[model samples]
Target: MLGSFRRRGCTCKKKRCTCGSMWYYRYDVTDPVTGKRKQKEAGGFATKPEAEEAAKNILAKLQNGTFIEEKDISFVAFTEQWKSIYEKSGKVKISTVDIRKAKLKIILKHFKEIKIKDITKLKYQEMLNSLFDKYAWKTICSVHETAGLIFRKAVELEVIATDITKGATVPKKQQTVEDLENGTEIPKYMEKEQLAKFLEIAQLFGNANDYPVFLTLAYTGLRGGELTALKWRDIDFKEQTISVTKTFYKKKEVKRTYILQPPKSKESKRIIDVDDKDKLVINTLRAHQAAQKVHDLKGDGNVFVNISQIKGQHLTTDDLSRRMKILLKLAELPSELTPHSLRHTHTSLCAEAGVSIDQIMQRLGHKDDQVTRNIYLHITKTRKKEASQKFADLMKSL
Candidate 1:
């Protein structure tokens, strides 16, 4: 009685109604706990035996207690669950998590209501194309990557039978020559004569606030964040060194909010030695400190405060960039140079001076000597040739 099939004839003008047609199956099952009768219907079977076998298998699964009810959870529901689990694990940093959350919101706007199983590879591709049409290829790729991660978690949790996102393709972005050349090629360094002329003009700007900050970045090779986070405690006038401990970022959600965190790596946290060549800069900082002391009587202690708002906090990265732009214009320097370019200039100057790679690595807080070597390879070759020529000159004198 649990498995039964019914044959139905097509309404065709045939003599015996012997033409093969659709068949239907019906099965009855009882809940083991509740003793309630449940009926299941399946149709479109070509033969009676096939219909009976399907019904028999269903009855067997019901009797054995191995039948699992498929859940119809939507894509949005799974994403929320995944995000909650990911946040609780604390594997990702807050800033990175915030970025991922933003990207997920964009994805949820389109495919949130669809069930996980309903998402086919074709549907995934269409979503990617939509994202690509609206945003940059890089952004579309980021969304694709994040979506894949979400689907992978769903598969791990058995929410879906498989990850449908795996078969989807991401479009490749076109890159300009400048984009590829960046970081691989170092811009020309300031010649000794250019350095002298630039410093002369730099001394003329002469403001205690902007000029000092610019000089500090150029002389110490500190990042804008590291420089902004500097405090009086970080400076050791007696030892002529500065300790880099923290970096800063402005949260995009709350524009004015500043977050202070450690540097990107262990190597970023190190001491920078100040040499006698920078005695002029040291003297200038001392004068600025005296001025800051008078201003801090009102109780603000940020080292790089805006001079007008002495009571206000130090400058942000945007503020530094704006100030640098103004200074570059005044110094008759090209607009192409950025604050980070000063870091490159510092490395180039040291390499050209015949400084050893190990010492340069320590000075620049680079964890990998290979990275330092790679960046300064051209300078190293020039230094090698100069050294060889010097040896020849000494031999001729002998």
Candidate 2:
């Protein structure tokens, strides 16, 4: 359609004003979605040719079906909209949606209300690189994941032409010089000896449910969520293995109580063998089962159910952490250690005992995780040092 251009706020009274005010253009373009022609206008050109060139570019883009109408939406606002749409999509659990919301907050800190259309791949990478010093690699990755989803949805909605997160790189956090000198920073986990002491105190002073739960965690390396989802039927007392195929789900904001869902990933579904030689973990579980029988508290037969609570009251990962803290306080162990720390403990001790990393990965139901690999590497390195020291001692005797 033919369009018109003119200058605005010009005071010259001639048919053509020579006043140097900025130019504006008005044209009618078909709405790509509605197929209805609508008048659009833009201003702030310094000259007629510049304005005409801009109009021609817009017309060319529209003819090629590549025009993107500017939508006055902020990044944070669009992300919230996507978050809402995602929550209502029913593709994943509410708990997962909650996690996305948390990760999205980390991204929002860098791009609060910045226009979604304005973020290019370079800009996104800069934001990620800035996080390397402040956040752990996993946290940065999670933030990037959430950012990717938001941008994908933005692209799908035609808000932007390409996903800004597509080519962005997240820089891994590196160990500090002090960390190399003092050894890598210790993740929250107990040493083998410390775990023994913690379990001893748990068995001695803690409630009936405490020892078995922590012992199982330390021995099997089950995730806190996986443990909370365990049931009596999942345990094989005779075969001495525990099947893990599901996890506990919770979202307090949505009033979702504990529910059983599939394991976190396909690799998370596996069976873990109890130490059949010592029989401590299996016996502890057997004793726990017996006690439940005595109290007639076997409703639905969950393995990690808090028996001290009213019957059938389920245990969650949070509940396990709180109990672990109280027991740690009593045992004078590091209070910062969480129930998850037991999983790391299991990996470390297994590596020390000559269990191959591959076996440990399988037993722990992990495809691969950085923290798990770190524990394995650290323990294996220590073992290598011990081997060298022993050889030196033998040579000294010679």
Candidate 3:
């Protein structure tokens, strides 16, 4: 850190102009392009403490590839840059990165190629207001998050004087008559009938692992990552439960090649039962295990593998998604439903079958999941009405 007490300050914002009796600092970082050392400086700080703090942040961002020099950067361009840095940074989980990537795409549609320096809070909030009736509140919040991060970074890097996202309020979800009448407000998950039909379709049209995989997902409510990480040893036929100790973390997201990480929470590492009354999942699993021993298809490492064209490596959540799309297309079910939606589906169905909410949460390895609770409550409300009607009919008959 350097400070000039008598010397006139460079009084500059474009990197660091020298002569900061006002303090300034200089540092070296590797250039992203040339892969060689490059000098960088940030100045115009009024106090030594201020200069030191700015110096630390600027040096870190520059080293981490977050602060790149650009002129008149477009809003979309700034967002894309911010997203690139954000994803590369190790602060967030890989899934959050993917979510932010998608959210940014939605946000950019409104901002277009307008220069980032020109966007006002009024303008940014207008875009958010436009989204209120069109999207769910949760989805709009995600868009707000993506936009907020970009503008905040711009202020932090001194590209803009103020963050446009500050004090911006996202529009709340509005209810329509259709939402009330058709149960459209419920979160995405298969109904009991839709699930049964989807399972049958998978049995007939799915590839080798598809039937077992989807069935296991629906029956047991394991997260795609947790299920993908399971080994043959994780299953206990004697207890009729599957132990979920670790989850498969995608290697590109982490440093380790053998990327089995612990469960999402301590509660996530519990045993869940398998095999409903007609002995379906266990029988399917038994048959699946036998197929792994076949000479051509090596299926020994993980519980779920590529018995189809991909061959031996364990299946990824993305792979499961692609297969689900294909099966959903074949089955004529909702294309929007993801593998995780099946977790919600299991909660709803189990609730209807008289499984208590606590038991379902334990089985799904959730300490306290609002989504699961919502689905369970929705199912029980329906059951409550049915019971009320049944009592009314019995009284009328008497």
Candidate 4:
């Protein structure tokens, strides 16, 4: 309920309140938990129409769910509420939530005590600009996104009237000279030949564990996390299939830890077919685990572990990356290649084998075909030459 009245003293848009009368508005808002009405009133509008208009707006907001009394709330306090809603919504991955929280620290340093309504577009732009001197565009963009989300939430809750980030300019990252000169793009994967050579060298080392881990990654295109989270039960030897049901993600805040969660997406939960040789390698790994009495530490059924480590815990993504570097050295492969390159290698190999992009998406557990296609679409010098030659041959025949 909303009501307005003109105060007794005198004013009606007279421009000077020297005459005492002013318009006032009163509204009744229900206490959410208690079945009682709470009356809120505000006064001092120069005109009765202005008071009535304000009352109407408040009534509309109350009718809808967006009404909230946060005009005096500090930005940090509002951020806490926003974070709670974001986490409870479960719309983003935990890793993404962690990343956003970390990014918010930078924002809180500058705007912690400021009211959300007072942080204008210029202020936010200046904050982003300050970061540009010390950080890359991508990092600054992430901060911008976090700040924008908070502000947008505030607006949706009627805590603020507008999103200030709407007009802020975020620059794109500039390409380096080398990137432009050579038209060189990041390699999607280790080439098939390079992968074969690396795997061959890994096999020679004959470690019961590391060799099989690499083989599984290459054969199944499982993510580093998915590979680490695998259990013996997830693999079917007769069917030559590996079931991807769970995933591991790294968390690093106070301390580093690996957490097991569901696979990244529905498509990520899949069964990958493996060749007979790969199955043999898996069997050999199972035998080696038994020989080493790994069943004690692997009681939870984590497939990959650092046997060299005393704890014998599940392998972390960072540890896997470090090990890949060492393997690259032994295989005489590029130092830039990492375990994720194996997935890319699998996608590229599939593309070269004339497999359709949809099939490649399934094989790689990618929800979107564009993701599978984008990585393999890079045109190399050799491919460019082959295309030119084919075009020339067609011209000659004509």
Candidate 5:
């Protein structure tokens, strides 16, 4: 016995009995909450003084409110609370929210069983390095970003004093040679003779309903989404301009369904001028529309609709791309070209024809001339040669 009890000296009748010489301490106190008596005993000390000192330290901690009860809370429980707070107040997109959930699952699977304070930078670095080895650099970066966000939230909520991942270093990613290879294979533009041949093939093998779609893409430089969302009311034949206001997004799971949304940016909402050649193409479209009218399959307000149906429903990017691929195969064109390459070709043509950078930027719905220039910088040498030749011609004329 230590506190609240006096030590008793041993006095045994037998030979050298030491009943009270062993070092042990026992104390009794009342539980504040339950009003029950409680006994605390600790021992294995070499001396009575050591036992008494230990007993005194325990008593001081209890009186000073420094004793901490071991908590049963876990990392998973805290993370769930963090997620509820994030969702209610965060402005995260749905796709981004889903990605965060996935990253959270990976973290919980690896570290949730441990106490939050027990996690160290070395442990987080090891996990990040392992994941980096198996995943792409972008994916690894996303994981790091998501983990940092969670840890930051933890710090804000006093769940941890410091984020263990804050100082962890991710290894530099190795890039494969195949990733550096230039994959663009489409020609910038068809020469006059090539254009003639392409048109001949289009007339011979392409469906009448599909030719205008291809023509529109080649001339206007509209993205596939923008082309899919074009309506008849958006075309101003008298002004020879086409208004690009909206685009179609094909949902990942539903292939046929299209969701109409605004253009990617304010610059993308533009009015593109129709050239004389494109006007002829538009006339062909109108003739086709009239022909469909006789069969009671006229489209609603859409400039381009399914030829076989009269519904106002629009085409999806995937279906349009598939149709264009079939047409390209039938015309004996290279299979590597996609519908998007048509817009590339349009930009290339504008650059080669000595169009002003500003005009090209506007026509392509680029936010600034630098965007147009950056994409077509490979043509700078060609432009230089053209400029030199033009200067020579000007001098000769003078």
Candidate 6:
């Protein structure tokens, strides 16, 4: 139907069509699949311009093969249905679902009642910008992804004509010099020397559990959650490797504290090589664990445990972070470094030792080598500069 179609008043004898105040457009077309003749009408338009605008939109949808005359569905209804299907599909983690639901509130606040078909990339960008000030980039990205999924589902169901989030962007806060100087920049790993000093101090003065956890992370590059979720069976002393099959994810729900979950990604489920020094540390930690009777509760076969003061309970990542903060302070190291920095430190040290990028990616359980390469390149370049300065000093002495 074209916008130039003329509208006519209803000629019904009774009060069937009160078309005096309103104008409508009527047309007949054959259904493509069923070959059945169907009459479509665009009604309730108060004026010719309104009817023309509706006709233009309807005509555009028809020309583009997105003409769905179904009743417009509210965003709230569509999102609720999509969420139920997505959560029930078991493709995403429960923790992820919880986080996504929490982030979705930011979107629902603005677009709850609006029709799903009316949402556009501009609206999504507006929502993202509104959320940019209060939330982190990670949270904003999650919200964007969640909203995108809902929109995609709507399109698949033929509820909407187009996906509006295709060109939307989640703006990242720009890093400033003050952020860099104050150590408020992206989280980074420790240097090899700094790691060595920190680990030595941790061994001497840190709690019994901190040494093993730090050693495992520094040597294996396991994520903090993976480190905490390690089981005794995952270790193979003869093969000198640790199999990563699961992780301990912290749940933000009020009723739940944390849960043992699968690895973050398929690549995360890998076996990391263990060297002689790491094996020795592991053996010593095992001995300490047995002596301390840390795994007394159901003898749950987890490799790492809390200190004796905490009854050797399984340590949360948060607990490990707290221990790391204290260890860094005592070791006179930069307080900005967290437990995750150990993983970065491990990757950097491997690169400095001339390890191949492919091998580093496998060891770190990364799905792709691009991020690993970037980190390796940065660390190697810095090391090269340091080496050149050291050689200059050597020549000066000569």
Question: How does model 5 fare in lDDT?
Answer: 0.68
Which residue pairs come into collision in candidate 2?
Answer: none
241-328, model 5: which lDDT tens digit per residue? 8899988876555647666767876798999988576477567656765654533344456666664443445656775777767876
lDDT of each: 0.73, 0.82, 0.78, 0.77, 0.68, 0.77
lDDT of 2: 0.82
Clashes of each: 0, 0, 1, 2, 1, 0
Poorest 10 consecutive residues by lDDT, candidate 2: 304-313
lDDT, candidate 1, at 251: 89
lDDT of 6: 0.77
lDDT of 3 by residue, 64-93 (tens): 767644336788777767878887887766
Higher-lDDT candidate among 2 and 3?
2
Per-residue lDDT of model 2, residues 1-398, tens digit only: 53899887989888676887778788787877999999877656777887798788778887887877756589988987898889889787766787899988778888896787656465688799988899888888888888888888888888775676887788975678887899655577788789989999999998878898998999899999898888889999889989998998876665537777888878999988885688998988888987866554556777766555555566877778878889999989987899988998998889889999889999988898777888888879877998999999999998
Residue 217 of candidate 5: its Cα lDDT?
80
Q: Tell me the lDDT of model 1 at 100.
A: 81
* Best lDDT among the predictions, by candidate number: 2
lDDT of 6 by residue, 162-227 (tens): 677888888998888888787522348787788889988888998767777788788888899998
Model 1 C-alpha lDDT per residue in residues 46-128, reported as the tens digit of each score = 66676676567666666887543324789888788889988888676566667789889988888888877556565678788
Stretches of candidate 2 off by over 4 Å are: 1-29, 32-63, 66-77, 88-91, 106-137, 169-176, 252-256, 294-298, 309-311, 389-398
Worst 10 residues of 6 by lDDT: 1-10
